[model samples]
Target: MSGNSAERAGELEVVLVKAGRTKIRYRSELLLDDGNHVAVRAPWAGEGVRDFGFVRFEPGDVFTEHYWRDRWYAVKEVRAGDGTLKGWYCDVTRPAVRDGAELVVEDLDLDLWRSADGTEVLRLDEDEFAESGLAERDPEGATAAVAALDELEKQARAEGGLTALLA
Candidate 1:
């Protein structure tokens, strides 16, 4: 689903992975294109750390570049404990300028997957995910999370097209 700016802002669910010595902890704060509010911070770090949530890499762990924005942003690829290559953790770049930043809504989507049966969606809903566990690579969550995503889409559209959130 697209849009969902303010909702995304309120719906922000961060999964903090405390990396071991070799593993690097990457704390990603995905915002819904909030004007001048889209920022990425360091793990346990307060105040002006670069928006790109880059952490020290641990041995045997791989962080690859995925989606790129302009000549700067590059989405980080995170590999979970299950050997699954998950999507970006934090991607930082100059957001697309819509109406000179007013009425601009950048889609902030945190995608999770569901099982082939689809019943799994309900088990790992948003709140559960917020407390239970993290979303695997390309894998859908329980019904509730999926429902929230659906609602988020509707809400996103109602806000002001896609650019409104960014604005």
Candidate 2:
């Protein structure tokens, strides 16, 4: 999974190991690949990023990422690793790609966080995404990406919305 080789795209599992620890803690499935970037869907562990401190992994903190090539943003469902619902985290970025046997996402830095109950929604890293000049490069796609986030947030707040998709 580490060579400069490309495979005939199909179903694949991307193992996410803890930064320092060697054991695999998560697996994201790549659902599709169209010679460009592969689409991955999976539950990701959530650790606070803004505070700039050590991130402690909780027992049941997970976010389900729904990634696709047609959309510029990937919508995710935040939940406990044990399946307790939390909220949503959206990342605005270029479509994912399959690097060797692994799926790679170059996160564009902009993100949106919404509480599980739909009460709090925060758009993160606006400055960074803007600084990257993605909007200037492709204004329409950038705007549509943000719109996709809005739509995903609304759907995530509904009962059985995100989890069903994950299933």
Candidate 3:
């Protein structure tokens, strides 16, 4: 989290938090950090193939993730090891916080996914979001999370979809 440009290129520890606890954390190569937006690249952190029926995340898959301090979501561009485009996996979360070498993001439990071909745009994990009782506990955060999910879905269905947002 240095202001110096030359110090930007290095390893960044990504901490994903859920329910006031750390969910998952991994190291990623910090590609860009322009104050508001932070981008990092990392290989799939899961141990085995995760088949979601729509997409499979296995070894040799890379994820280029984008997080914003001013936004309530994070977008991840998934690609195969051979450089084939897969799709985008987006998470509805609280605005990201950069603490020294650690980038912390809180999972709001809502998610959206868009296929690379733009043939399928899915809203995922709404049940989990509701079950989390965010609305009862934190109404404002719950509202923001829903709004973020809506905005992401709209962008995913737009003409350029996620490509336009990533670009």
Candidate 4:
């Protein structure tokens, strides 16, 4: 559970869904699956370097992603090919669902980013979240998404930050 030495259960197809459509689907090495929480390792799924000023996700970046079946968020720890810690990327989403070899998660358009040194903790896509009209369409879901984002941001700012949570 702490390392990648755990039994490898082949691969899992991670499906990111938004607005009732699949936004991205990538295969990841299933590292840990404890019924409630699941962890996987995968390379950057983006085509090229996606520089966002704060961070860049390139082809050689590796992502150790964690998803919870009960939590409304997913946390991904990004590292370079040489094993340099980049940071953590969190997605506010509905609880993940596992069906056979597929893991499905619905994005709520809210995300959080934390720098490796913990100097930068950014709450992103609030405007997109608001403009998504999820509040009007699904009030409960919207509320949950907002709450999840807040929780993640708070955790990312804490003393040990996401490191403690992920550990």
lDDT of 2 by residue, 1-167 (tens): 42332233433545332212333334555565556434555543334433212222354455445655455556666556677666666776556544466654446566777666666666677787667676888798678756755665655566755444444
Question: Tens digits of per-residue lDDT for model 4 on 49-147?
Answer: 999999999999999999999999999999999999999999999999988778899999999999999999999999999999999999999999999
TM-score of 4: 0.93
Distance (Å) between predicted and true CA of 38, model 2? 7.2
Positional deviation of residue 157's Cα in model 1 after best superposition, in angstroms? 1.1
Off by over 4 Å in 2: 1-60, 137-141, 150-167
Q: What does candidate 1's lDDT look like per residue over 82-130, in tens digits?
A: 4454323332222323232122212223333222222222111235444
Strongest candidate by lDDT: 3
Candidate 3 lDDT score relative to the true structure: 0.92
Model 1 residue 54 lDDT score: 28
Query: In model 1, which range of ten residues has the least summed lDDT?
Result: 16-25
Task: Tell me which residue pairs clash in candidate 4.
Answer: none
lDDT (0 to 1) per candidate: 0.32, 0.55, 0.92, 0.92
Candidate 4 stretches greater than 4 Å from native: 1-9
Q: Which residue window of length 10 is worst by lDDT in model 3?
A: 1-10
- For model 4, state the Cα shift of residue 60 in Å: 0.5
RMSD to the true structure for each prediction, in A, is: 15.8, 6.9, 2.5, 4.3
